[model samples]
Target: MDYWKSKVLPKMRLIFVKAGGKKAAAAAELVKSFDESKGEINSEFEEKKADLQPKVVEIYESVTAPVKVLIKERKKVSAIKKNSAAITKLFEDLANIEFPGAKQVSEGISKVGPALLSSPIFATFEKIAKLLPVVVEETPKEAPAATEEKKDEAAAAEEKKEEAADEEKKEEAVEDKKEEAPAAAEEAAPAATAAAEPAAEETSAAPAPEAEPEAAAPAEAESAPATAEETPKAA
Candidate 1:
């Protein structure tokens, strides 16, 4: 009785009172009530059991008497069948036996079996079995949402990477332009110097013409003296 109160009753309670939400709240309330009133409930159950004990024993004897007789007779028969190596024949012989009250016992078991299946306890156990897979299936349902979020994050990262690459390419192009500017200036400098050299040569050659005019005036003066001296020699 103590073991049933402590162990079996809690397990029975848990089958009906699941462990989540409103059910968890109800289970907690049930546990609190059990804790507060366990002594009273146990006393009441004991009184009820005492009241019904005699009838329960009578029913138990009535149900088990035939089973006990069957077991004893089966053992005796099996012992003989084992010596003959004929277990199947023993079962066939037992099936033929129609003890006076056997029909009532078989009918009682058949009625009780269906009643147990239709009971609230069995229904609660079935419900718990059904809920078991729901908890397992919940995690997989959330997985797709997380996977989609990860895919979005990866896409954003890829976009950022592409933007960074484009910026780097633009910077490289600007740097290439900057490097080419100096090379272009250096090339233009030699061309500019080559163009100025022809102008400088033209200016120097113009001054040489003016100096030649001055030399021509000096030559004219020497020629006049030579002609005057030649005329005096002829006289």
Candidate 2:
């Protein structure tokens, strides 16, 4: 058992942890892809899980069974001691092993599993199995809604831009009409002045006719003397 703990269990823990880390990394990558693709991770996620789950589970069970056996037989195999004493005894027992790389394995187990019955790694794995799937399922649901909201905002902005452009065109048309009004009035002023000039000239010529009649009366008066002389000749 000491040899197994120092040699086989440590290697098994490495394999188990590595598989778990790979699964975690793959899941994280899938989630990132899901966000980029607007919530489209279902197929890829299932494929990756299918490929990785069996291997992870196999290694997990292999490592977990031994660790659980050790934990169950801890009191019978060795007397319970303080955490520090247990770690020290475990290292001392490892030193007796004559394997090629026994020292390194011993050191690794000491670092990873100081207390075999109460290993933190075991608890952590349990938590991962329970919680990771929940996170994977629920995290992607918000992505589509967020994407739709961004699309709506973009459409609203485009509509506002179009409306602003139309308003600018209307204002330009109004300004053009305002500018044409003065030019039209200026063109009509000359024609109006020409039409009134004839009426003004007729009013000024009326007094000249009166003066002509008065001059004709003086000529008639001078002709009366000539008429008297002619009457005497006839007699």
Candidate 3:
């Protein structure tokens, strides 16, 4: 594990190298034992890692994205110290994932994890990385806050589109009414002129007063003509 490598192993090297006689012999024996067991350790580590990869990837995907942000901003002191409940959950989950000699590594974290700020976070990840497929940098998924902002923007744009569409409809209606006003007046003008033409034609085509007297005389003459004609008709 990374903790073993970074902390315990160095101390081991220092102590073994510093001492002489029995200590040097014991260190040699220990190295031989590790070498003999290396094959088994590696095989077990690999198997456990394969099993844990699924859960690790799941955690990486589901951890509220703060974990990724923390890892991405690990270099910054402020960012590194950002305490995320998701990261705490990550530590808890990592503690549960077993590997070859996993206890030896997580022992430090279990003791110091709750009170610790940042280093153990990285250290926990480092161990997980060795034992699981941790995708520290995949795609940066948007947080709920960011997702809501996007939704708001989309809704605003949709509202604007609806407003624009409504305005266009109103303008079209106004334009249609304007056009109809002129068309209706044009229709009415012809109808009014046609009605007036018949009246004017009747007035202008009326019989004259002179013609009326002549038409009356013929009727009167016909009525008197029978008496004068009767005298001559008797012979």
Candidate 4:
């Protein structure tokens, strides 16, 4: 029996036993805490379980109860408040009081529901109105007056635009005149010089052909004297 137990049993135990690991000590501690042989569970783990159970039960009850019915009732009350005429009438009937009408204002609210719902300002006001039982007044809003000052401002803007256009046109005309002035001066210069040439020639004296013949006769007289003097010497 010793030979079988020492040789076969130890080998059999090695075969059955899981491979020991880095986590074996932690796993053994966990096993010891759970084992009835060690006694009841650790006090800290039991206390944590007790703390979590009530929260778990609360969550379970909330998920299982009539959540849909509560949501539906809240929506119906909201709708009743939205239809203010109906609520007003309900209040009037129940309390048996003769108050001012709320039907027209209620109709206005209904007609402008989409506008009111889209506006944060109107939506917040509407929520406040729903909470309170005050009657909504439909006071008429006056159209803004067309003051003389506003009309004058519009006319002034138009006049300023016209003045700007006129100034632009005047600037263009001045530029065109500046460009044309040089061209006009170039064309007039030759005509002015040609006209001056004729005037200068007419005013100045040009020697006549008759005056040249007269001047040559005087030279003829002076040479005769010299000729006479030479002849005497030759004789």
Cα RMSD to native, each candidate? Answer: 24.1, 19.4, 15.4, 25.8
Q: Write the per-residue lDDT of candidate 4 for residues 1-235, one digit (tens) a residue.
A: 9999889999877765644432344344433432432222233323444453444333323431232232223333344334544333332331222111222223333443312222221222232233333345553342233466688899999999999999999999999999999999999999999999998998786765567778988899999999999999999
Kindly state the number of residue pairs that clash in model 4: 0
Go through the candidates in order and give each one's C-alpha lDDT: 0.48, 0.53, 0.62, 0.46
For candidate 1, lDDT tens digit of each residue in 40-155? 54454445544444433333243334333432333333333223322222222322342122232223223332121112212222222222222364577799999999999999
Cα error of candidate 1 at position 11, Å:
46
TM-score of 1: 0.31
lDDT of 2 by residue, 100-159 (tens): 222333453454333332332222233224322222654678999999999999999999
Better of 1 and 2 by lDDT: 2
Error of 1 at 210 (Å): 8.9
Instruction: Write out the backbone clash pairs for model 1.
Output: none
lDDT of 4: 0.46
Deviation from native of the Cα of residue 125 in model 3, angstroms: 15
Count of backbone clashes, every candidate in sequence: 0, 0, 0, 0
lDDT of 3 by residue, 1-235 (tens): 9999999999998877676455445444544544566567567766677677777666666666656665544554354336544555665665566545334334433433323334434544554555434456435565766889999999999999999999999999999999999999999999999999999999999986667777999899998988888989898
Best by lDDT: 3
Q: Each model's TM-score, in the order given?
A: 0.31, 0.34, 0.30, 0.30
Candidate 2 residue 149 C-alpha distance from true site, Å: 1.2
